[model samples]
Target: MVDRVAARAHETIDRVAAKAGPAVEKLRESASTYREQLHAKADRLGALEEQWIDSARSYVREHPFTSLAVAAVAGMVIAKIFSSSHHR
Candidate 1:
């Protein structure tokens, strides 16, 4: 009787595993697709960041004085914001 019970349990586990095989494979394929999509998006974002950096560099090179003035003004504004927030 004990042997019979053990055999039945093994059979049940085997059946469950067989039933789950296709579902597990489907999940793996879906995960691979999502991974591919995420990689593509990351690549595009990296390119966009490079483009923005290049454009900013060009702008600064063309207008060094203007860029310096803008940066100074921006710095003052940021400092004021931070100081006021701290006082509050």
Candidate 2:
């Protein structure tokens, strides 16, 4: 009778473990997918940052004063927008 009870207890433990194994596997799979996605996005952002740097260098080389003027105007516009928004 003691052996039978021990066998049933082990069977119940095995069943619970079997159910938990799939849930743990699913969590690991989702974490892997999310990690991969984040890495891909970081790579894309790196490429975009390099492109923007190249563009800015080229723009500065071509037109220093024009770039400054445009930047100032845009900054003023943005500030004005933000100031107006805050007032509301």
Candidate 3:
């Protein structure tokens, strides 16, 4: 009787595993697809960032004095914001 019960338990486990196999495979394929999509998006974003950096560099080269003035004003504004936040 004990042997029969053990055999039956093993059969049940095997059946459950067999039923689950396809679902697990589907989930794995979906995860792989999502990973590929995420990687593609990251690559595109990296390229866009590089493009923006190059554009900014070109702008600064064309207008060095304007860029310097903008940088000074931006720095002062940022410093003021931080100083006020610290006081609060």
Candidate 4:
């Protein structure tokens, strides 16, 4: 009886592992696909960011005075926000 019980337990474990193997493989494939997709998206976003930076640099070169005024206004706005938060 003891031998029979141990054999049954071993069979049960083997069956569970067999059933789970395919499911685990499917999950791995899904994760790999998602990883590829995320990498593609990251690459595209990096390209877009580079283009934007290049455009901004060109614009700044073309209009240095406008950029300086914009920067000064942005600085004042940021300072005001920080000062107000501190006061509160």
Among the numbered candidates, top TM-score falls to 4
Task: Give the clash count for model 2.
Answer: 0
Better of 1 and 4 by lDDT: 4
Angstrom error of the Cα, residue 35, model 2: value is 0.5
**In model 4, where is the ten-residue run with the lowest total lDDT?**
79-88
lDDT of 2 at 75: 100
Per-residue lDDT tens digits for candidate 1, residues 13-80, read 99999989999999999999999999999999999999999999999999999999999999999999
The collision pairs in model 3 are none
Over 13-41, each residue of candidate 2 has an lDDT whose tens digit, in order, gives 99999999999999999999999999999
lDDT of 4: 1.00
Query: Model 3: runs farther than 4 Å from truth?
Result: none
Clashes of 4: 0
TM-score of each: 0.85, 0.67, 0.91, 0.93
Looking at candidate 1, the ten consecutive residues that score lowest on lDDT are 14-23
Best by lDDT: 4
Q: Which residue pairs overlap in candidate 1's backbone?
A: none
Put down candidate 3 lDDT per residue, 1-88, tens digits, no spaces.
9999999999999999998999999999999999999999999999999999999999999999999999999999999999999998
Q: Quick one: RMSD of model 4?
A: 0.9
Between candidates 1 and 3, the one scoring higher on TM-score is 3
Q: How much is the lDDT of residue 84 in candidate 4?
A: 98
